[model samples]
Target: MKFFRNQIENKKDKSKKEDLAGASASASENYHSLLECLHHTGELKSQSLVINQLKFMLIYLETMADPEKIQKLILPALHKCMSLADLDECISSAGSVKTQSTREAADLLLEGYCLITVDTCSEFWLLQVRADIHRPPLEPENEKVVRGSHIGFVEDMAVNLRMIRQRMANKKLVFRYLTKGKETNTKIVLAYVKGIADEQVAETIYRKTEKIGADMIFSPGFMQEFMEEHPYSPFPQFLQTERPDRVMANLMEGKVAILAEGSPTTIVMPVTFFSFFQSPDDYNSRFLPGAFYRILRLISFVIALVLPSVYIAVIAFHFEVVPSDLVIPLKTSVSGIPFPPLLEAFIMVFTIELIREAGIRLPTPIGQTIGIVGGLIIGDAVVRAGLISNMMIIVIALTTVSSFSIPSVEMSASLRLLTFPLMILSSVFGFLGIMFGLMFIMIHLCKLHTFQSPYLEPVAPFTKTQYKDTFLRFPIRKQHKDKASEAGGNKANK
Candidate 1:
């Protein structure tokens, strides 16, 4: 009986040893497979360590994972870890996840997570140690405002989301994450306020974003182009801004904001024509000043779009429309020029565009110097050579200044583009041509829809309630009262 008991106990111990051996072998195989699949990239790093008498491996991408974090947090935790439960307790990372599949573990490793493999354990522990790689959120040069929060969005998605959260501490603010770009696997976040944002609009944006089949989405512009309703339209369907306050304001108004990883620009959807003209400075100032500047910007838009065309029409066909006193001066200015008014305008406009392009491409101080010196030299030389008229130069300069007055760069660019068609029409058919071009533009604006919202809005669809905040901003107190009354009326109707 005693001999039989001893043999049975030995068999049981042998079985236990076999089970441990199998687990160890399986873990080792998985680790080797993961390494093979990840390939031998320069940034890929692996460290072997002995923890609590068990063989362990730490694998991560040096470019994506923070080395200091692994040293300070992960190494100490591993030393204290006697078992998986101890690891869970001792590791400081809140985003640690466990996976047994080699493929899943490899994916985690690429995403800046530190992967821990224990020789006798099938599961791999993923620790969040992503590198903090982004610049400080300094105010964007293009989106500068005279008054308001100077903070702007950074390239880091996590930091951008935190900025939004810090500004608007509302529970209703929701974020939906989606991955796009098969090759890039870029992270995208759709942010909107619940109950305020139209569910259909949000869903439309999400569906369009998810359906994109591109292999690489590097910037917000790429996503914007893919999701825009009117891809061919010169006007931007989405409002891209770097300011957090601007994004917050749009969110409050039931607009959706799309943020992409690795881009500082945020794309706001369903914006109207007036939205592009709006500046944070408008709201920061008193209602009167805000309204004045807003109206001025609108006027600037018209001038930027039609000023050159109007000049061409007047010079080529409608000399009578010019004030009798100024007609002589206009005639005198163009009399000595060799080119026709149309050619003259084109030359000056093209010259301005060249200077503008050069200025943008060069360093800041040098750019300003180039713009000023180049403009003066070129304008004087053209006028002296009689290739471009003095009057045409003045007109083109005014048009350029007017275009710059518009707050939105996209809209400003659109205006610059529209100028060419109108200039051609005005040169051939005079005022009638200008009128036809304006009519077509208005028709396009009215027909254009951004996510089913009228592009013109409040004006074309004629919403009386929205007028308070449209072209002319009413006093904040009065606007609030109107909103309250409007809400009350809505409730009563409901």
Candidate 2:
């Protein structure tokens, strides 16, 4: 029995030595391949070092790596190191890792990690030395608010994630990283609460992100177009916001947020038509005031979308609906205009759009000056010249104000565009045309699905329980109780 045991132990030792020899050979081949792959790039830099008579090579990209950290933290630690184990202990960065694959080492080098290769070791070390350069989290210009946290997302994904984690420290909040864009290789993060967010929804988002085949994805808009169910729809399927608080609020309500590197905007999915009208200021104020402003916004949506069309229809085909007292004055104001109501409407709307675009493209001070000069001077000159009617001016100005009141920029722009089609319909067919246009819009809203979630939720599906928070803000305690009761009912049913 002792002789057989000794023979077995010898065989095991020989097998172990053979495996070690194979690994060392593979590592040597991989090291050379990694160097050859990166040699063509101008930013690829390398240095050789001798530690206790052992040869070592350091490789990294100069544009992406931190020179200060390599000089102060990495080089000094390497000078004191005697072996691979000492190298690990001397540099204490948390992002250190070991790999034996050449492809993985090349990827790490491009991602701002320093690769350390030793002549006698079978694996290489990767140390995080990414450059820290980003703008401070200032308030986003387009999404500014009056009564809430002023912090907004920056272009850096790490800083954005840190801000989110700082706000909500719950363990349930989870993030999954994905890399898309064949050429750009942009990094995207999917964030959701583990239990609160639906598992199926998360899975769907993952599948869609994995299937994105674009070569360049520089902004959130690119991903939005690819992932949205209906790319041609005028209404935005995903809500884009730069506010971390807004993201946190949606995460708590079982929605997913898609954040991309190098973009400050975040895309929130499974949003409803009502989501575009909500503002953080609504929740920051008293519930009654919040509800009032929310309802006002919804009213503005109708006014902005259909008000100009209503005016055109009335003036062109159904002048009998006008009040008797104001009819004469309206006719008098419009009598001298040579163009028909349709052409008059087009001219003014087109002019307003031009002014709006100019204001956006120019610098802040110049844009403001252009808007004031264009609105006051051009509007008065056109009216005195009898090119446009006084009543039409009033209607167009009111429509512009209402469109501006919408909280979402995408939704506001959609409304502005939808206005023209409705105006054309009303001009041709009167009140009947306006009604038909509205019906078509309503049908589209009902049929639209964002990741299988109804776009017109709580209205088309007719959920009375969700009505408390849809068009109006309910009290916090009441809303929570309702949600808890609904959750309990769902669990019991299941």
Candidate 3:
């Protein structure tokens, strides 16, 4: 209780300080007001420089402001200037120079821009000197492709935008920027192709994005949760990817992408259920091979979501479905097992999930070792100890492999999570329960929408034209033989 009281007292003290700072900031006298507002902030820096007999004060955030740019370019050029006109002429090459009010100046300072103030000047110039700190674009670990460009989006928004623009030279591509988060003030960019993109969808996304007023937004996921229509749904509506090429492709398909300043992943909006199943390899490989793998992935999705449940249902309640040839072996395998199918399935599934999660969180070499031990050693020991049957182990292994085949990490996770409920339902009602669960998921997918675009596009509404590239990849162009050449009909030109 004393600790709680102390915490409350500390918060009250902070609030009082903020109120005092706010009151002091509004009382004009520019320089004093700025200093008072920045009080208690240790990173606030002020430098005094003289240029041609005129005294000036430059204020900025030390951590965000670039020292080399300030000392080498700004100060040296300003030292030779005689007046505001000369100052403007000298610093014309410096990008984004503007005169701002006190509030705007304060915001600029925090963004790494130096606020330049003369002794008697009422307004101050805000110069861009923000530090460039970002990781170089590296191939995404999860979205790897063998034949396509490996470069992926970095945390830097400007660099990510440049990567897209570098590949797509179309002038119609547009970027609409908005600032979200009250405390963080994170920069977000909504990118789309002008004529090709659905204007209504773009407008809806922009409106919803602008409406976000969170105190802090750290990632694309934050924006997604805040604005997605069905936030409670396990399946992700917006497709997130780190590849700039993927963003460009989606833009061409009339989809919009949302990029957050500090996030490496960007979200493509109005995506279909099939969109998450696609990979860069689909376009890079031959059409037949691509379509084959695409169909295989779809099958994998079904298998991942229902195979274990089907096994449980059949063994527990519908053992007659088993073929006579395999029934003896199946019976022998389960005869030694002590627990019922439901409990046995749950235990093994939970163990697989635990191992998979630990493998991800641990370092790579150790993770691989753990996977080998858990999958081989632990699994073998459990079967020998009669805790689980060999057939159950096979079902779990196939389920794990199938889930890993999904291209999107979010989609894969959702499929894995849905497995538990389906398993429970199937254990209760056998094949009937599995059918009911599938029906509900289908209905949910049909009802889901992103920015008013159907979630199950080309399937629910059934557009045949999109099928050329949806489940299959068709060649971009094919030459047609001229009938005139074959039949010799055009004699006039000859």
Candidate 4:
């Protein structure tokens, strides 16, 4: 019985070898056909070499393939080689592969691999000769921190993933890659903790990204507009950050991060409205200072969004709300203004926006000068010209400062944007219009969802457990033991 089993196993092995040989033959034929298909392209380079009287065809893309490697490294090694097997053995000095599928071989060529096809052998070899050219990782201009890792992500996806892996060093950290953009073939990586991340949320995000059919995906911000639940909404659903520490922190909390090649910024998903308000600087400091700054940022959010509107409402129709003592000066300041409250407010706000934008677009040294000189000159000139009131200037200046206090630039910009509509409404109907605008914003926040997780989060759905980390940071020892729960996976309402 043992002899019979041995004989049957030998036959199976023989059959497997035969099948592999047949497949290789077909692959070689298909590879020739693929070469013919690409023959018309001017960059398709080919060279012939004879080793032990056997003719071999070497093919590569001229633009991407390294000529130095082919001449200095590859040819010297292949000179004495007679067969594909020997060639493979010699090329072990560098990364090379023997592939059978023609489609795969073509793909390898695109990736800067040199293909060697021997006339006598069915299997072909692909040699790696990719030239890497990219800028070194530098501190991101937008996400500078007072304390923490100064190294930020560069445009290279491999380097970004390496940095992240070095920090995490966890087996559960899974990075699933996908190629979007039909024309650009842009690569995107979705990273999450396998067991910690909510499976449903991750799967939904994966499906949405996979379903994207755009012709080109340029950057992380460009891709974000497509993946967000509400493109029409001013608020950003995903938090964008250049800090790998922030990305790793979010991953530990079971949130998924999307990283696109050619983009330094990465997107963190299933974020709450509060997520943008929090910054890496917060955790870098002591609990007391971090919590205090966190609270201050939240207050800034309110002040930035409503300060101008409140000013408009009070001066236009709700003057009784102001203290009687200050009313005289306020009235005197506005009495000389040539326009109504809304028009005056709009002129000052528009001028500020223009100055801010110009300052940003100018060079740093020039931008500071522009911001200081332009602001002082414009503010003083407008006040003297009676085009805008001194009180309105103060209100607008406060509003700008409050908006600037928010850590996230996108959120700060959105807050600034909401100011305009509220100002308009408050100008017409005073307090009632302001209330309506607030209600509309609240309803919009409640209706918004990120990966099916509520945007308003603990506040709207009333999840008491999450309050520990919401508005305030609790003591470190008071954190929940189940780290995944902090992700708010189950606590969140759809």
TM-scores for the candidates? 0.93, 0.90, 0.89, 0.85
Higher-lDDT candidate among 2 and 3? 2
lDDT of 3 by residue, 396-487 (tens): 99999999999999999999999989999999999999999999999999998878888888888886556666676665442113323433
Superposition-based RMSD of candidate 1 using all C-alpha atoms, in angstroms: 9.6
Mind giving the per-residue lDDT tens digits that candidate 4 earns over 1-494?
99999999998986564334321443345445556545557776788877777677778888879899788877887887866557667767547787675656766787788887776577768888765667888778888889888889999898999999999999999999999999778899999999989999999999989999999998777888778778999898889999899999999988999998888889999899999878788788887888898899999899989989899899989899889899899989989777988988888889989999999999999999999999999999988888889899999999999899887999998998999999999999999999999999999999998887899988989877777677987666666653456557657853
The CA root-mean-square deviation of candidate 2, after full C-alpha superposition on the true structure, stands at 9.0
Flag clash pairs in model 2.
none
Candidate 4 lDDT trough over 10 residues, lowest sum: 18-27
Better of 1 and 3 by lDDT: 1
Q: Give candidate 1 misplaced runs (Cα > 4 Å).
A: 1-28, 83-85
Instruction: Name the better of 3 and 4 by lDDT.
Output: 3
Two-way TM-score contest, 3 vs 4, winner? 3
Q: Rank the candidates by TM-score, best first.
A: 1, 2, 3, 4
Question: lDDT of all the models against the reference?
Answer: 0.88, 0.88, 0.85, 0.84
**What lDDT is reached at residue 379 by model 1?**
86
Mind giving the per-residue lDDT tens digits that candidate 1 earns over 53-154? 878788888899999989977898889888766766776467898766666677778889998877757777889898888898999999899999898999
Q: Which stretches of candidate 4 lie over 4 Å from their true place?
A: 1-58, 67-73, 92-95, 100-103, 118-124, 480-494
- 156 Cα displacement, candidate 2 (Å): 1.0
lDDT of 2 by residue, 98-190 (tens): 777666778888899988777768777889999988999998988888999999999999999999999999999999999999988999999
